[model samples]
Target chain A: MSDQVVSPRPGAQVQLEMAEQPEVLARIVGRRTELHELVRSRLPSRLRGISLIARGSSDNVAVHARYLLELATGLPVSLIAPSIITRYHHTPDSRDHLVVALSQSGKTPEIVDVARRLADGGGMVVAVTNDDDSPLAAAATVTLAVGTGRELAVPATKTVTGQLALVTLLAEAVGSSIAEYTGGESAWAALPDAAAQTLADERLLAEAVAVLQPRGTAIHLARGLTYCAALEGALKSKETSRRVHEGFSSADFLHGPLTVASDEVAVVAYGARGPVLADVAETARAAAELGSPVIGVGAPEVWNGVPGAIGLAVPQTLGEALAVIPLVIRGQQLAIATTLALGLDPDRPAGLNKVTATH
Target chain B: MSDQVVSPRPGAQVQLEMAEQPEVLARIVGRRTELHELVRSRLPSRLRGISLIARGSSDNVAVHARYLLELATGLPVSLIAPSIITRYHHTPDSRDHLVVALSQSGKTPEIVDVARRLADGGGMVVAVTNDDDSPLAAAATVTLAVGTGRELAVPATKTVTGQLALVTLLAEAVGSSIAEYTGGESAWAALPDAAAQTLADERLLAEAVAVLQPRGTAIHLARGLTYCAALEGALKSKETSRRVHEGFSSADFLHGPLTVASDEVAVVAYGARGPVLADVAETARAAAELGSPVIGVGAPEVWNGVPGAIGLAVPQTLGEALAVIPLVIRGQQLAIATTLALGLDPDRPAGLNKVTATH
Candidate 1:
């Protein structure tokens, strides 16, 4: 049994897909000019608001969208609770609102259901999905394809990045320039190479992996835009490594979940520059003081000075949202690496269907 | 040191507070008529929407509000991203929105900040907090005090129920009659005794506890209103037992997170009679088949027939939202009981403050 090598060995598809994120993102960036115009053309001239409906990793991406869209466009953005449609048979009036539904399969029953209802409610329905031929695309007023050909691994690496890229374009369409929004204009175009750099950084990734005790639980923390990275990171860890990794808004942690921190647990936090970074540093310091092993992912200055913290500085970038692209890859790599260390296959996470069906 | 018992031993405050929920809820229910009049007077003649700003356990309670208010009033409800105010200094137009901010202490800087910003945006701000003299109440146009007095335990059981009760009363203020909202007309009047009945059911709770292996992680599942119970349950387990427990929308879990379940994990699911109940039952069946222990909390018929599943039927009720109150108490008890089983103090979770001050 020990000598037999399983087909599609541990971490195979996930590693391949993670490596492909650079090319996939570059493709999205190269098409940004066309994508931006497409989004602008579909959007209502005077959008009263924006509401996003999504599930799983796509939902984490929507969290980033909520922050960016509201800040840039000065419009209130919401994450629609799909059960209100699927279970309660209710659809709050979305007239004149840009209701965006995101799904990798474009066939998740709830996501598709939400897209249809938003359209029925006079919303400007925009479907952001990987499948252009799926029912979600057919139901939407406009479809923004992710363009990632196929995602074999159930954990969803490239598709998540693809969704983030499309939402980034959506932000640009809504009158937010990358430079003004994040203070890093070149950051969008540089994402591919940045992700590649993160994927290739074996030194930090190895050190971070070594710091993880094989079977310990993990707590992820972040604030503001980078917080979505913390969530996606935790999801990846949970899906692939089958570890108990939950993410919290860093500020939310100080509220209650901080009690779970201890030497027996690993705390992974994401930070960027500014006051949010200060909170992250304090969180790391506090977690370390409680004897929890702290792995910090952010700019050097954010985590470097925190005593007893291990730091993995994602490539420096200005837009906090754009910076998350590279940071998320770091998390994906860690999850895959951790899965391999545990002798599990990242591609075939136990009992996971490629496309889960639930009403 | 070994012979001396610590004062206010760990878990004591949490247990005492849990026991106080019935009295506290009864007090709130007794005031519903007068409280309803006060809320009606404070609200605008025509509200465009509702936005709730909260953090931690209070935020989970807000999830319940989102479902109830939207289902009843046909108005859009959103859980505000507090960082948008505290960090970004961005206030999206909330002109006719009834913005409600909740906090146990009414002193969480972020919640207070959100209330002030909502007030600045021409929104009628309401504060649901335990402290009427606190800054959040001062910043708001109106305050609905939870009246839990001083909640010394870090886990926040009584105040959470107190806050839930106030939100329930607020729903009645906004066009939802207690009888029509929850199918059972007596649900509201019966809440106090229902909670008391749950607290006295030592047999079911003991069975539930025995099903929870001391060091194993637990996954909580539910749909619609009961999902909030799943979240609070997970939070209590995290705060008190120091165990890895996370809540997920039942449908969302199928998309991902289910991969983490195994023989070493326990699944605690909340269910009631509805279409959503079928999804919960299937989830329990699936998790049990994956070799995880399944403890179902709902009506007997929803879970009793599932092979290898243990059912703890909560007292039956009509409104899905109303049913959550008793279920949450069960979760709180499991958290404290599990803490005892693990030989840990629930009253003082490591490194947690009663009021977390984070920016």
Candidate 2:
């Protein structure tokens, strides 16, 4: 039951080589040309709205893309779950829409079905995936290969980051100037370095794990674009840690959720622009004063003065990169810790299947 | 810990009584008078888009309102959480939109502050609340009073139904003729009776409680407008039963969540128009066959053939009423049962508070 101890098996070196190497991930990244070509070749005659499909980590990518596209071009957008589209499989009469399907493996049956349904309905399908030859790619009218190299862990990391990059590029193609203004290209390029820096202090993260491991609930707060990142983080935490975690806007947290503060509670705040960051810090301070441990993730400007807080200096772009990795790592570690603590196997969460087919 | 002896808190009573029946809720039936008022009162002179601010049960109401308005007016609408609005308390310079805030008590401090902020920012504010004298009501430029009678329970029931009634009226006001076709008036009038009917068989619900009380995770599924009801139900169940319950569209559940189904899981399906109902029931049946207990809270047609399923018929209008009372009762009973089982007090959840305020 002791929370401290590192296991010897498939350590960070393997993850770094397989999941983080720029050259490895660059395979997916370099597919931007093919992706652009696929999208252009299958461009709709008229555009009314864009629909994005994904589930789990890929779903996070889809949501980010939706916001990025709207912010960039003020284009109308909708998110269609693969299950929904597949159930109603038919050619949509509307020719003025585009459907984008994202999956890392590109073999998920439902996603493949969704891509096919959209295409059959005469709607253009764009598949963003790591595997170019997977069913999703085959069904898609256009396939944007994410080339995230290989993901070995059951939980996704590099692929998720790659999906974010592809989404940013897609948003750029669709006329989102914010991507340009936000220095997304540089941010994307700096990911490997940023990720390396984040993992540099595994001991620091391990200490954080010690603080958080006992808690049953974690609250993640972020605003605007970063909110999506927080959501992805929370989801990973939930799936990996088996802990109840909710991702909400920092400002929103202050309104009501902060009342739950206790010494045992863990609050992770993603400091974003606007007064929300300050507000969340204040709430964290209040929680700390109440004996709760608050972990501040983001810039010092946002984390200053928070008591018993782990202030991780995550820049906006670096923040996005740093955010998902910790969550994945924490989730994996916690899953191991929890399983060992409960005398179970980390390899298998009870009653869970690797692939889900609704039919 | 014994399940057989559990009984409901005796005697049904009319909890809420509207003072002066607003014609909009009482007579107009399905008309969207409130929506029209919201649009006419708040929209920019040119009218382009809309954003909504609401929390708790009202948040669920806002989701439905957003969906209906989008379908009817084709206006881009987004739901802004009250926390987000309160976090960014500054007024926007643009007047091209409106922010509608809904609350039953209208005294929720955060909601009141958000309403004031929206009004101060020169954005049109519309308050849909039962208490006309509440702070939220006083802060709005135009307030639509839903004369839903007093609610005594901590969890909202009639107020939510009344709120939907008002939101539907608002949709009519905006010139959406869908209300007329909804058969809302007959449904509304039949609600009390339907609620009574559902409560008549306390044994059935109590048996359901036996199955649901022990579970740690639950998913509530529904489609279209009824999905909002499911969301509220899930929230109530979580808050009352002190369990982790997520509400999602029946269609959305099949995406990836289906992979985690087990015999011990509980799936509550709220059926409505379209294939979503059947799809969800099928999913539930598959889960049930796998050993999970499936609860259907809709028409029998949707629940047919699902083993160990409990069908609580709620006519569309009456559905909200029928579904909510039992939900509240079930939640309260579960809370009591779980509290006793876990040696905790039903009055307090660990690390949670009644009212949350920023430091």
Candidate 3:
């Protein structure tokens, strides 16, 4: 398995490693102030609606942004997919809508097209991207470069978190106190330390991988913004480990998916702050008792009343950080572990490609 | 395969057959008018804010109701899953909310509890159901009985359509002229005949089934009120054929799932009355051209421009009816075909029971 690992070009390898680091994350966080300043200055203008557009992990970031902005400003906000907007091209009247496009690689053709359409339709455009000179940035009315340096992994890590932070700042600028509502400032500050702490807890992570490695299927569960995170997490787990995973709202899991719980299945529940969290946790624990391995990810103190439990007390800040980095590591570990279990190469699966393009 | 067909009990078989006939459907439609009258008389009082509670297919019906009501009255409405509300039982002040629960059997424990919770909490309760004497009917402040006689198929068909029509009527009664918006009394009256005509198109039905049967995965796509119908279709497909299917809005599909489209897969696009339908049809057609077969279900003239299309045109009313029934038949056919492909009995799948219950 180790012999099969053909390392990428030296520069790309370094970028990938940097993308996995806590310090790199902190640097991305520092740029939020500038982005917020720009967004605040434009909020009072006669914008009819706001649209956040992205793809894959960036799409999840847009969802978080939409939720935050809607809660903060009570403004009409819609999460737009670049493919949906461009390929379908439902032009909102230029007089009212603002389009915000998030893309780690500002060159993704879909993102560029969506931005161009909004600009062409005379809607205000804001591009949040990791690359400053990319086409998406060039096409936008205002470009908020997410200074995340470079990202190399196919599954976005640091860039997505950076994007979320940047979007939150934008939401705040637009009079959404969601950051305050969600203890955002503290959560942002705690992220770096949280990343460091979670990584330091290698023993717990190793245990988690051990429990999850044998399972062929998993259910990823959470609510609200965390639900979006769970979906990305599930996708990461699938793409990296070649496992079948489905994401569901925490409460929704109990309605039907719970019936299929088995000893070989694992249920990963993200405990978000809500009145229903306790009930969701209890249900997760019950599933564990019923044979499915259950992993609870949330603040430690939050599980006080959760019954029949196997708790993995993830810090709130760490929960967000781990949403990206830990999943990648775990996925990588599972790949290696499963390969060894089946006597195969960890780095290569038959008929697989690192980058897939369908003609 | 013929010999493998296990006959259901006479009474259940009769009920099931009755549930599929035009007369039973018409009876349900008549009940919808009565429901509309009841709701209209009580409305202006229930107009401020509405919250709907439902589960499974019934939940989908509530979404349709929410959409039509919002369109008609411009009222604030929310569709709440029973599990979510039940989990958040601590929220005592729900008086301003009007809760409508839709279930065919009125026996699902979750639905029963939701009705009791909303009614017991002083929220207005309305049950749109077939079983007039069922517990859910008794628990509700108002019961709108479809009187569809009985439904024997494990996968619900006509009852769901009944629920949808009833909910639409209820929405109309609550201050929105949904009937008028949908083209007045004439259109509503023509629906049953349209539905029958659609069913009689056996060749189109078979073609749709053939396209859908071979796929390992499918995605049912729709938007707005029809989005809920898409969900029900996906759920039915999954439960009956044990296939992996997901539902998403026409606009939402481009976010990530489009990456998986291949000729071997199938996607069923539900066309609704709106500009979005053209975009959805075009996207589906593109997907079909890329190899995934796309089955378009809608009014004939609505998606005339869809590319790479194998179009199945049904009248608007017929489209709704065709959507629910053909899937049930397709499920049965797929199960039989797959069973033969795998050299198994058409009547049974390994490790599955006629009734599934888990503690």
Candidate 4:
């Protein structure tokens, strides 16, 4: 349990939560070894694959986990469409499967249903949550609790990044070679401090916000690991500002949706130093050349020489996988600033509750 | 191999292919038994899970297969993100896995790489393609071919629906009791007729177009089985028109992003008589209440009494799973008509090639 959150100003809970991310990351970083041991203990010995289940912001975190698991452990991953179990009543077999269930509150009914059923059917359920005693946590074989205190705002900020941190720890534990590419566990010590530096610099987020039009579809693009940040960025913009901010894989965007890229759409491309960053950069450059305003999210190096784009720089990480922590903070900042620009309260997004009860 | 496609007029290839759905469905329907036997022969002994690999429109069809496989076979499924294989070079163990590799062209480099690598890793590769002689077919343990002639148009209509038809057959074969819910293999005999009847009717799509604005975001909503239709519809619209047409899971919409629903946006809700239909209708109604124009895609029963929405009705299928065939046709028609309304050529989409080489 955590203390009640209070805002310095009226309707500023989301802003406050957004600011708390670094401290939360620091706490999570301190317990990385414990988190690793916990995940290692509960992992299925025969680990055939993974079934990830979550909703809303947590669901985006699951996508990041999918890429991590496959790349690290060579284990295929599925984000369970909870409706397949909850509504369709299909009790899918779970032998040798690991269900990474995530929820900020650990209370989404459908997620709980999925985790419980999969666990009952011979799967290992690992609950990544702020609440360690919620229904979801009870159903899990182990809980990877990364508490970000109490989140009073509807749009998740600290809680979600917390989920990302925990799942990244998960990938680090099971994936033996993941550490080599990403500076390993030793490098995680700098995560919280890097996040703080990112927060101190608002120029990149401001640059992105300055180019974004008040109307029309806003596009977000990324490849590989950073794609999750793009998705969360788009969702936050939509929820808080009521703007149609859309996200797509840099590769997936080229397949067809590239037609929508023009001056009317502001495209934000996220990347870090890794395998697919060049391709992502190329896609962003192509969109910029097509007259769409482009905002590139990465370290200064990602945009220092790139033309036709503004840079949303953060403290660079060793590899693309670990870059998600700071990139997500940048995304959340973009959403907050965008919401404020639209004269809407960032703390209270419309048509949403702290807990969305979707069955 | 198939005949070269000729158009009656310039930029009419996509329109012509859209009109050929019934014939394509008829051919696929006639060979259900053969498809069933082929799938049975290649079914992995003690199948542990399924890995679905695809991109663009073919990828949406893979999502449908995912739902079908999980609902029927009770086996977990994972959609392989090709980057992990092609970019990262991770050789995941695919033993005891059924890899459903879909590419209408079967020439996508990434899809081929994944299918080949997974097969080499011991997965049973099943290629669902229009080109039986393509690299993907060579990489497969079995190939399910559903030819619809050459797709000259940049936007695939018949080829995509053909993939849908074949995957439905694949589902029917493995998802044994899936028939009891969806009226069985015998009921598949009416598939062509049903598709023809759907094509003959155009009022529903017209109704939808009348309400869709020339500018702003268009949202497509669906749940479970019919979610595939909504995704394809959005993709087609984005490709054909330079418009922003987005898709989401009906249940997933309420969590956030609902704030974006307003008069400036158009919402299209897709459903069939299934467990989650009511929830989808509620979401559409909520969006309509927010002043966003609403289009309901399904049979007469789906929209007969529903207020605050225009209906895009199709010939009724027996159950939600079977309904995707007709719903997809309706979605394609919507995209074509939407493009025509925008003074854009449907046959030749801007910023798109027939096969997008993402890798």
The residue ranges of model 4 lying beyond 4 angstroms of the native Cα positions read A1-11, A300-306, B1-11, B300-306
Q: Score the docking of each candidate (DockQ).
A: 0.72, 0.18, 0.12, 0.80
RMSD to the hidden true structure, all candidates = 3.2, 7.3, 7.9, 2.5
Looking at chain B only, the TM-scores across the models are 0.94, 0.77, 0.82, 0.95
Give me the candidate number with maximum lDDT: 4
* Alpha carbon deviation, residue B33, candidate 3 (Å): 3.8
lDDT of 1 at A278: 78
lDDT of 3 at B141: 81
- The sequence of per-residue lDDT tens digits that candidate 1 reaches over residues B1-359 is 23222436667767788899989989988888898888788788888778899999999999988877887777768788888778877787878788888998899987888788779889888888888899999999878887876777778998898888888778878755545446544887788888888888877677778878454688988888788889999999988887778888888787778887787888998987765888887877777777778888877755776676777766775467777888898789888888888888887788877778876
Candidate 4 chain A lowest-lDDT run of ten: A1-10
Question: What would the per-residue lDDT of candidate 3 be over residues B152-239, giving only the tens digit for each residue?
Answer: 4444556766776677667666763554345566656776766566555544555666766665557777665456656766665544
Candidate 2 lDDT tens digits, B1-359: 12112123311221122112223244324334444555466555754445677766678788777655554554545565443334423233325456678878787787787667657767677788877888888898777766654554444555666677666556555534543324455655654454444444444555566667676666677765456756776665655454556666664455434434565567777664443557767767765765767777766755689877877554445433223333333333333444345444333334444333431
For the candidates in turn, chain A alone yields TM-scores of 0.94, 0.80, 0.81, 0.94
Q: Write the per-residue lDDT of candidate 4 for residues A1-359, one digit (tens) a residue.
A: 12435456534888777789889988988898888887888787888668799888888899999998887877778889988888888877787888899988889899898898899989988999998978999999999887767788878888888898889888888767677555676568778877888888887566677787454678888878888988988888888878888888888898888988888888888888888888888888777777788888885545554576898787765467778878888878888887787677877665667788887
TM-score of each: 0.96, 0.73, 0.66, 0.96
lDDT against the true structure, per candidate, is 0.81, 0.57, 0.57, 0.81
Candidate 3 lDDT:
0.57
What is the TM-score (0 to 1) of candidate 3?
A: 0.66
